[model samples]
Target: MTTIAVTAPHAPSYYAASGLPQPARPALAGAVQADVCIVGGGYTGLSSALHLAEAGFKVVLLEASQVGWGASGRNGGQLVHSYSRDLDVIEARHGAAVARSLGSMAFEGAAIIRERIERYGIDCHFRPGSMFAALNERQVRQLEHHQALWQRHGHRELELLDAAQTARHIGSGRYKASLLDRSAGHVHPLRLAQGEAMAFESLGGVIHEASPVVRIERGDPAVVHTAAGQVRARFVIVAGNAYLGGLEPQLSGRSMPCGTQVIATEPLGERFPELMPTGHCVEDSNFLLDYFRLSADRRLLYGGGVIYGARDPAHIESIIRPKLERTFPQLRGVRIDYAWTGNFLLTLSRLPQVGRLAPNVYYSQGCSGHGVTFTHLIGRVLSEVIRGQAGRFDAFAGLPHLPFPGGRLLRVPFTALGAVYYDLRDRLGL
Candidate 1:
């Protein structure tokens, strides 16, 4: 119901600075008809457009900015499997049937990413492993349980490492142990996003950058309107996620946008191996966690902390530098070349919200912080649902989404209070 202007340029992050060169796409200027019209240009929209186009559908994708301009281009780039909340939590909250259904698709996202990189020859600096670093025994136990839970869900590529083993992989002494996922990895997120956009266009999908949808008129064929033009399509896919703004009231209440920040150090050159010998991306096992990896040029790309209301912190480096130093004290005075923030949609359930606004209007959002891989999977699922295969899509859509306890005005403070409590618990090793 509320229309927000989409005027911001891409964040000046490392990804944006070094991303693949892409041509500027013109904004939608005239009426267009298509089999499907997709909102947003991030991973979800790009993936849906690519998949649907491949399926022989005439697809037109509308971007508020350039492709990968949102979180899709700005994420940590770690290929973390599963959703924000793990399958164990899903099984406990919902039933095993729901968990099983969701679990079957858990690792599929990462697989889809790898397949795309290979099939499209996307040079996104694809690496092949991720580590879950454990700072205390409690976290180590959690990682152990995490490994077991993933194994139960048919993910057998995990290996638990003792402190000594972990030391070999990560030069830091901060972690007590770690769990390595061979199948999980990292990539140049922005490059990957640009590549996906290219792939989508290559399949005859139309893309309009700087075209933000102002409203949707539901009918036999949905009408999506922007400032310059409108799209009439049989089906409309809303993949905007955190940047979706106030376009749909149905989705606005159930989720909140939260910002996360990252900083990239000047390329580590010869010292890279001393920090990450195996080139594995790592995320610690704390509720509010730190994830870092070696970038293609060997710079340490470290990210952590969350801003509940998606507000950019004044000094991103001030917030993250301490954590980075704590992990590797040797890099205490390392010069940071870039620092930036991006927002991700957070649902109360910590699972994605997927369903229909109307019979012909479908949406998928709220990946919380674990969207890099899941968004791609959801895109494919959205295409599947459009193409008459709704089983997998139904499984995700069936999950219940509860609104935040506090109303819009109070949600941010309330969530921040809760995060502080959990952070303290994490410090106390409870």
Candidate 2:
């Protein structure tokens, strides 16, 4: 319900301060035509635009603010694979075939990212390796099953680490065990977004920043309208996850925007190795997780906790600093150089909602808390669907999406109550 302003500036986070320089792109000022028009300039839109343009489609991307101004720019920057709900959950809910289809493409997004980075020479400080740390025995057993599940889906670049082994990669004794995914990694999220934008433009795609789409006039050639101008295109892709307000009532109802806070410590310098020795990104295995990694400059960037209604916390540092220090007591009074919050769309099933708004109007949203890699895969699937290859897209589109039981009014409280139960379980190590 908290709509992002059209002219909003990027959050004052470490990524914004240290990201690659991107020139201001002009907003839409007049009517234009393209083969495809994309709403939102985050990963989804950028990937779709870049892929479509490479496939020889005239693509126009419209962003409410600047590219990556939303959660795409402000996330933990970990290149985590799969959906927020995981493949085992998908199988339990939707059956094996559905899980198999999704699992096949689970690692493709990270692959797409590496491919693009190499092809376009993106300088986002790409590092390859991510660890899912477990805090208790129960979580460790779950991770063991997790490794099997991923391996069943053909993902082989994984290693299960005991506590002693985990200590080598992660400098803390907080975790009981970990699962290291060599194929997974981290990056400067904002820089990656900007680099993708540059790649899209290099392929002759058009981007209009600060052009918040007012509405879409669905037709054979859909018209995406903004305050200053409009884009008439053969197809339209709605890639605005949480920042997408009431532009589409259908999308707004099934998903809720949840805010997560992150804080960056001052450069750790020599102490960086004392923290994360292997330089891999790490996220703990808790119901409400804590994720952290070393930045290119060796700063410890950490994030945790979720606000159900996307409300900015009164003090972000107060919320995140406690968790950061709890994980690493050595930095008890460490100065937090930057603290910020960003919203990601959370669906009832904690799975992404991918389907069509109309015959020519496509959409992908509700990445839950797993957008970094999934968004890229969704973009490619969207492009494939538009190119008359809807098999993969249909696999995702067929996933059932249900609105929250209480709908918009009480959805926040309902979800918060559920989160409380899970958090309690996490605390009890049940």
Candidate 3:
């Protein structure tokens, strides 16, 4: 068991380079008391803290690093609906009742983000429209089914585009079809996180940075011990996703920390529009996928290449640049300005793992790399469960979260081998 820490500046991603300035938050000092003590400072934790504080609860949030320090601030920034696995898969593995319940709230997370930006006046470059592109006939058929499946769940805002239409919007010939969701959007993630932290503070919530919880003395009033301080609270929420290593044995086993790297090019200026004609964030339909979008300043932000364990590529660009060039050959020599990597929790079920770790201790993790939007929704659900509205929370809890077959020790190798099969299928257009 190891602990993750980041007593440093945010990664040099383009989002961090251009996002709004943030106030330096203080670390936990002495002993503090609150109705709730939330661990982690990423999307889920911040969202949970903000909503909980707004609900009139005294909240204290502890982050090992600054806000948006993990994947929350370092994702591809393409916000869309649905879980990591599609709704049909959820239905097949679970059941209609469970799938329907999860599907109904699929779009709510994106709505929550938009509402936050509008309500808190957060300037995270909230841009609407997300496209799921199909690269082969099999993928096209899958998308066709995806559209119908979403429609059955009361989602009718999807716009299907033929190859020509897809080309028009995508400015690339690699895709055969597209499913566009007008309500889904992209944002400046780091800024959104920072803005959210500010809003939480404004709502009388307290945030302690660099105060990694070293131990949790669980009880009626759980005590969360940090390196230099402790939080005694009525309830505790563990919102740390992938960056949370070894904090709890149960959590580390049921979830695997998967690493993904992304790169941002030097301001593309006029060339940006040629690449993303409509400026809609796009992700291709594949088991392991590629997602890209234009930054507010017009730099092309491309992300791909997933690693099952914690080792990041020696140089992220060395792995991602080829994908970027392959996707847009015209930008063969494009100057890469920023490259970095972050980890997201992946569950064996490919669904989010959310429920109580103890009677008074709750947790939410493993968004399966599709967490940017879902985290916000889970945040609300967590707050609701903490306050006695367990109906919605129970829906997620009812879903099974199996531990990796080989546990943490061999889960990485086993999962990586399984992924190679799907990667071949994707390559063969199966």
Candidate 4:
């Protein structure tokens, strides 16, 4: 079996930068039992905890660091309404009915986010505009097809924007056209993750911080061994995503892990209007995508670049700085206040992997860069499946997923090669 050592959560993320002060929670140091045990305290785990707890099940959540410590807290924060992969990809594999169901659930994910924000009164700077901007004619055609697909399912919340209309919304000429989905928007991810954690705790769910899961013994009842404690539960949910580590070796190399970095600039003042005039979250159409949006305080939190084969923060600023400058040359002199990197699980097909490693052992990961929305939805679907409603989760239960080539010692080399191919495509305007 392939093995990879685990790393701690990312440091000083933009989500951490924009939030209130946090207190340290004690780590797990003993044995415990629950109806369900969830590994990883990010969006998926927390969402599972909230739903299962509300359903009257005793849930225990284990976090290697703090809650929101993974990609959930360190993402680009663009809550878009779709799977990371295209609908055509889903249709080709799962057939028309299942693919259409998966597509609708993608929109349901956005609705779930909005519902949580309002119901819980989460003050995460919830904004309601997201635009999938296009850079070329091919992308424009793709966006129009996407708009029609969603509209056919009564998701009329989306509207196609021409070049002129797109410029009016984002105030950047980089995009030739775009599709504006009014139902989706951006959020302070850390705040939302924390709110879900708090809600889980309120419903009597137990959470242990700084408790890295070491291994799992699968049987009638599974045991989750942590560095300091162990959890025995009737059911186990592995929501670790790219940080699954050795918890489930079968899942370890299934998705390639690529590091994405972001930089938050010093507040742009009233000059924020010069960036995204419409205040809509924006992302370009490319494999190596560039996404940026202003914080509530007006700092432009810009992010892009895919680092495979290694975890190095030293070269992040140099690689992403020029990309930021190219997008808004007006802010060439703006100083970057914070820069950091987080890993996303990119699958071979760029879709999500949600199914069972064993009948009682469930796992969900590989959302590409689309986890901010998809993960939360998967959490809910996971809970439903656990409660004997597997129809929604089954749509994604079977799909093509190949493990990273070159095994443990060479997974990076192989993934880096694939990343280079995508990088070249992005540059050549493919």
Candidate 4, 1-430: lDDT as tens digits: 3222244554776778667455556677678899999999988898888889999999999888788887888888888877877676678877888777887787777788888888888888888898888888878888888888777666898888899888778767778898888888999888998888877877888888878888878887899987667899999999998877766777877777778999999887876465777788988888778998888888888898788743757867787889888877777878888898888888877888888978898999989888988888888999999999998888888776776666767877877777689778767767
Full-model lDDT for every candidate? 0.92, 0.93, 0.89, 0.82
Measured on C-alpha atoms, candidate 2 has an lDDT of 0.93
Who is ahead in lDDT, 1 or 4? 1
TM-score of 3: 0.97
True-vs-predicted CA distance for residue 202, candidate 3, Å:
0.6
Which prediction has more favorable TM-score, 2 or 3? 2
> CA RMSD for every model?
2.2, 2.5, 2.3, 3.4
lDDT of 3 by residue, 48-120 (tens): 9989999999999999888999999999988889898888998899888988899989879999999999999
Task: Predict model 4's lDDT versus the native.
Answer: 0.82
Q: Point out the higher-scoring one by lDDT: 2 or 4.
A: 2
* C-alpha lDDT (0 to 100) for residue 85 of candidate 1: 93
Candidate with the larger lDDT of 1 and 2: 2
Q: Which stretches of candidate 3 lie over 4 Å from their true place?
A: 1-6
Give the lowest summed-lDDT range of ten residues in model 2.
1-10
lDDT tens readout by residue for model 2, 230-251: 9999999999999899999899
Ranking by lDDT: 2, 1, 3, 4
